[model samples]
Target: MNDISAQAATLQWNDQGLVPAIAQDWQTGEVLMLAWMNREALELTVREGRAIYWSRSRGALWRKGEESGNVQHLKELRIDCDADTVLMKVEQVGDIACHTGRRSCFYQRLENGEWQVTDPVLKDPQTLYGKS
Candidate 1:
């Protein structure tokens, strides 16, 4: 834990005291999702070996899969050269990473100048989070 804190101290957090964390598939190297991590959230993620993000909307620490069961187990964590961003190589449980039930958050592509969703939802959000 101390080691993680020492490493995290080297990161260049933004004015909001958060860094952008990019989660990637450990085996395939596909990017999953982008989230924010405050100091505590980052530390907890390292300690817990799972994805823990700071929710800008709810203003709290969001434990990935707490509601949806799409938790990302941390395989490796890296800091960029500029120390402004974090990369997490994770094993995504349930094979879903997006709240929209897609495999990745970046499942949209722009074709002919029009944004289109290029991936299918592996599971329904309502099925995971319950109707509400």
Candidate 2:
């Protein structure tokens, strides 16, 4: 098998045949987002040198920044010891990773028994997605 296929074969996929993938900023080490990947997505990501995920809601392959202008260029990919999770260090283009127009999907923090939004939206979602 090819390198991509060999690497993918080592992963421990869930019952749904999906594994969790985490995207982190290549320079800052800040986690940008968490998504799922099937074998196809994982192979495509390795070959294309970009982030590709399986969107459960859409039930299809999701190319990062396909709708917006915030593509993630892969720098490095690592698998956890258990081989069930993937961590990707990438250069985030347009400084946005979240569909909400935020730099990271982890925008919420819990403090004092309440959840608060910590990151500001870099761009308006409507503007990014052309929703309005």
**Predicted candidate 1 versus true structure: per-residue lDDT over 15-125, tens digit per residue:** 999999999999999999999999999999999999999999999999999998889999999889999999999999988899998999999999999999999988888
TM-score of 2: 0.96
Off by over 4 Å in 2: none
Q: All candidates' lDDT scores?
A: 0.93, 0.93
Error of 2 at 23 (Å): 0.1
Inter-residue clash pairs, candidate 2: none
Q: Tell me the number of clashing residue pairs for each predicted model.
A: 0, 0
lDDT of 1: 0.93
* Model 1 clash number: 0
Task: Please list all clashing residue pairs in model 1, or write none if there are none.
Answer: none
